[model samples]
Target: MTGTPEQVPAAEFGPPEDDIARLWTPHRMVYIGGQDKPADDTPAQCPFCRIPAGDDESGLVVARGRACYALLNLYPYNGGHLMVLPYRHVSDYPDLTDAETSELAAMTQTAMRVLRAVYAPAGFNLGMNQGEAAGAGIAAHLHQHVVPRWTGDANFLPVVGRTKALPELLADTRARLAAAWPDA
Candidate 1:
C-alpha cells in the first residue's frame, strides 16, 4: 500500500545514499528575522558599539587596535568572514578621524594576514557598504568587510538555495584567528 508524503520511507525513494550530508542552519532564521538589529540608528542601540564594550572572546573579536577592532561576522558569507570598524559610533567613512582611518586600514591589512595564516583562503573580497541605500545592514555604524574565498567555494547552494555552507563555527573560527593574530 502507498503511504502519505510524510510517511514515505527514504530507502524506498532511490538507490542507497551515503555521501550526501545536510547542514541544517536554522540559526540563520534569527538573522533573517532581524532579531538583534538595532531598533534605531543610535550608538546606544548599535551592536557594533556594544561589541567592543564586552570581553573579546564573548564578542568574537579577533583583534583590537587603538581606534578600530576586528570581529567575526555574526552572519558570515564565508567561514572566516570578519569586519573591521572603529570603536566610535561614526556612520560615514569620510567622517572618521585621521587616527581612526589609519587604524582601520592597518587593521584590515592585519585581518587579511591573520586569515591567511589561519584558513589560507585562495582569495579575498573587501569593501564597506556605506548606507542603507548602499546595502549597509547597520548604516548607523561604519564597518569594512573582509571575506576569505577558496577555490570552488561557490556552488549551487547559495545560488539555488540562498544559503551558504560554512564548515566552521564562528566561535571556533574566532579563537583560531585570535590565536594566529600577529602580536596576539
Candidate 2:
C-alpha cells in the first residue's frame, strides 16, 4: 500500500520542527548582504553622508541639526535604537569642528530624551564604536549609538541564538520618535 505524492503527509518530506520559535526578520538581509556598506573610507562612499541627501522619512531621520542628525538604526539592537552622526562624514571624533561637536552632543542628548518620552526605557546605552577594532560597522563614518534598554531586555534568544527579537518595526519606531521629538 504505497501512498501517492498528495496522499503522503506534508510533514513527512520536511524537517521536524523544534520547540524554538522562529522570528523571521527578512529586512535584516540588507545588513547581512552588506548592501548599504560604504565601499571605502571616503565621504563619496559613505552611507552617513548619503543618507542626509534623501528625504527625512525615507532615510529614517528622526531629527536634523545644523551639523548632525538623528536617524533610526536600520538594524536596531532594540526598539527605538537611534544614532546621532555628523553630516561631514568624518571618521574621528576629534576631526569635527567645534560647531559640529556641539551639535552632535546636543543631538545625542535629544535622541535620549525622545527615546525616553516615547519608549520610557529603564536605562540606556549611549556610546560610539570608534574604529573597526572597536566594533564599528561602518568604521569610516563616526556615529554615536543611542540604545534604549529595558529591564530583562537581554533575553536568551540573543545570548543563545545570537538573534534579537525586536517587537516594533523600524519605520513605526521612527515615526513614533519623530513625532515625540522636541522643537529645535
Candidate 3:
C-alpha cells in the first residue's frame, strides 16, 4: 500500500516474503530480509520478545521453561505454526546441553500436538537452519520450525507475487491456539 506518512499502517510489519506483497509495517521490515549482517557483529535484540510485548497478544510468544519453550512464529509459513527454542540461546545446535536437547524434543512433540489440535493440517514441515548460508534467519539462536501444511496448499501466490496468502488472520489463529494450549 503506497501512501504518505499519515497513510502508513498503524501496526508494525516487515518486507514482503518476496515481491508480490510489500510488507507495509516497520516491524517486519527489520531483521527479516536474509538476516541483516552488522558491521559491529553484535546480535540484535530478540524479536519475539519485542513483538509479543507490544500488543500483549500478537500470537508471538515464548512459553518459558528451565530448558526450552514453544513459541509462535510471527511470520508463519502456515496457520497454527510455531517453533521450539532452548532457553540457553545458542545459535548452533552442538552447544545445546543434554537437558536442553531433551526439552527441545519434548516441546516439539507438544508443538505437533498443539498444531494438530488447532489446525488439523494434512501434514507438517519441521526443520532447522544451522547457519547463515543454510537460511537461518537468526544465525545465533538455533531453533526448529513447525509448519502445518495441507494438500495443494502451495500455489502461485508465493512464487508469482512473492507474497503469502493466509486464510485466517493471526489473531483468530491465536484465539484457537490459546484455547487449545491447555491440552498441551
Candidate 4:
C-alpha cells in the first residue's frame, strides 16, 4: 500500500489551500505519503533535522531548542500555522520523558506568545491530536497545534468547500514571527 511521491505542488490553484485538508480522511492519498497506506508516498524525515543542514527558512519550523522544537504546519488551520514537536518523535504524551514534557509545554507557551504578537489573535485553539481517533495526522509522532482564533475565524469557506482562508503569506508570517521571537 506504499508508494513514492510525485512532487506535484499542492498550490497549483488560484487561492491558497487548506493544510487541514491533508488530515481529512478522503484526501489521505494526497497527504499521507505512500509509505503508510499508498503505493509510494514521501518518506518521513525528521523535519527538525533540516534546520542545521539547510532549508532553515522553509517555514516548516518556527523555533528549536535542545530538547524539542516547534514546526509550522506548512498547511495550517489559521494564518499562524505551528506545531510543537518533541525531537524524540514519540506520539503519546505520557510516553514522553518528564523533561521532554516540560520542554514541550514551555515551547508551546512560547509559540502562543509569538502567535499573539504576530497575528494579534483574540484566542487560540491549542490542542494535541493524540491518535487516529483523536485526529493525529502523524499518528506516530506527537505534536500540538497552536491555532489563532478571532471572534468568528470560522467562516463559510471551510463549512461549504472544506477550505480555510489564510490571509498572510507563509513567508511574511514566518519573518514577522521570527523577528518577534524571544520578545514575543
Candidate 5:
C-alpha cells in the first residue's frame, strides 16, 4: 500500500465487497457534499429565513406562528421529522426575544401533538444542536428538531449502511401534518 499514485494498483483503492447488500443512495451525495448549505451566516444566506417567503405547501411549512414556524426537515431523519424555528434570524437560544422563545416552545409542543395525531409515533426526540461543535448542520440560525420515533425506526440501515430508509415522501408527510395541525 506504500506506493506512488501511479504505482498503486486500482484494487488497493477500495476493499473487496462482502455478502452484505448495497443500498445505493446517490441522491444523498448532494447533502453530504453540502451543496445547498449557506456560505455565510447572514439572513440572506439562511434557508430558514428564506423558507417563509414562499407559500406553506411549497416550502413544506406545517404550521406558522406569530414569531415562529414549523416546517418539515428537507433531510429528515424520519418520516415526520420536522423543525421549529423563530422568524427572526438568531443563532443562539439565549438571543431569542421573549415572544420568539414563547412561540418557539409552543410550536415545538404543537409539532409533537400534531405528529402524534398524524403518525402515532411510539416516541419522539426533541432538541436543538447549538453549534457546529454540537453537530448543528446550519448553526447560524437556531432551529429545534422534532423527530418522531417508532420501535424499530433505527434499524441496521442507518447503523451499518449509514443511510435512513424513510417510508413516506416529504411532501405527503407535510400535507398530513399541515392538515392535522390544530387551528390557531
Candidate 6:
C-alpha cells in the first residue's frame, strides 16, 4: 500500500532537514547562475581583462603593481577573499613574463598581509586554479585566489546548502582592504 503525504514522515519523503539556521542570501543567485561570465574565452570577453581598464573603485581593485593587480573576488568564498592576477590576459602560468610573474607573486603576498592586518584571519588558502579542468571559473585569464580563513569559518551553510554568509558588502571590503594595503 502506498503512503500519502501526511502518512509518510517528512524525513522519509525527502532529504532530512537539519537544525542549522539559514540566512537566505538570495543575492548570490546571480553568481550561481553565471550571469556576468564572459561569452567567450578571448581577452575581449574576459572580465579580468576588462576590469583593469576602469577605475579602481569600480573594479574593486585593492592594489596595483607594474604588471599585476590585486582585487576582491566578486563572489567571495569568505569575507576577505581576494584574487591576484597579471594585466596581460595570459592563460598559462608559463606564458607570464618575468616581470608579470614577480608582480603577481608580490601582490599575492601583500594581499595576505593586508587581509591579516584588516581581518586577523587564523589562516589562509592561496593557490591558482590553472585551467577549467582544475576548477578555474575563468580559465582564459589566470588568477590566484587568496581566501582568508578563521576558526569556525567553514559553517554548515556552505557544506549543506552551498551558500556562504558574508557579513560585509563587496564595496566596503574593497575600500577597507585598499586602505590597509602596504606600500611597495
- Compute the lDDT for candidate 5: 0.92
TM-score against truth, every candidate: 0.87, 0.87, 0.71, 0.72, 0.90, 0.87
Expressed as tens digits, the lDDT of each residue in 1-184 for candidate 6 is: 2689888767686534887565778888898798998899999899999999999999999988889999999889999899999988899999999999888888888898899999999999999998889999999999999999999988777888888989999999999999999777
Per-residue lDDT tens digits for candidate 1, residues 89-172, read: 999999999999999999999999989988899999999999999999999999999999998888877876677998988889
For each of the candidates, give the backbone clash count: 0, 0, 7, 10, 0, 0
List the RMSD of every prediction in angstroms: 4.2, 4.5, 7.8, 9.2, 2.7, 4.1
lDDT of 4 by residue, 17-125 (tens): 5553332334333554634332222224544333434554773566777778776776678888788878775768999999899988998899998888777889988
lDDT (tens digit, per residue) of candidate 2 on 1-184: 2599799877786545778676666777898898878888998988889899999889999998888999998888988889999988788989999999999899888888888888899999999989999999999989999999999989887787677988887888888999999888
User: Stretches of candidate 1 above 4 Å error?
Assistant: 1-22
TM-score of 3: 0.71
Poorly placed runs, candidate 6 (over 4 Å):
1-20
Predicted structure with the largest lDDT when compared to the true one: 5
Itemize residue pairs with steric clashes in candidate 5: none
Model 4 clash pairs are 1-38, 2-38, 2-39, 2-40, 3-39, 3-40, 3-41, 4-40, 33-41, 34-41
Per-residue lDDT tens digits of candidate 3, residues 1-184? 6777688885534555675544333444554663533432233465533343364365355354567766777677777778888755577788899999988888887778878877788989999989889987767677899889998778765666555667787777766666676543
Candidates in order have lDDT scores of 0.91, 0.88, 0.69, 0.70, 0.92, 0.90
TM-score of model 1 (CA atoms): 0.87
Report clash pairs, candidate 6.
none
- Candidates 2 and 3 compared: the better one by lDDT is 2
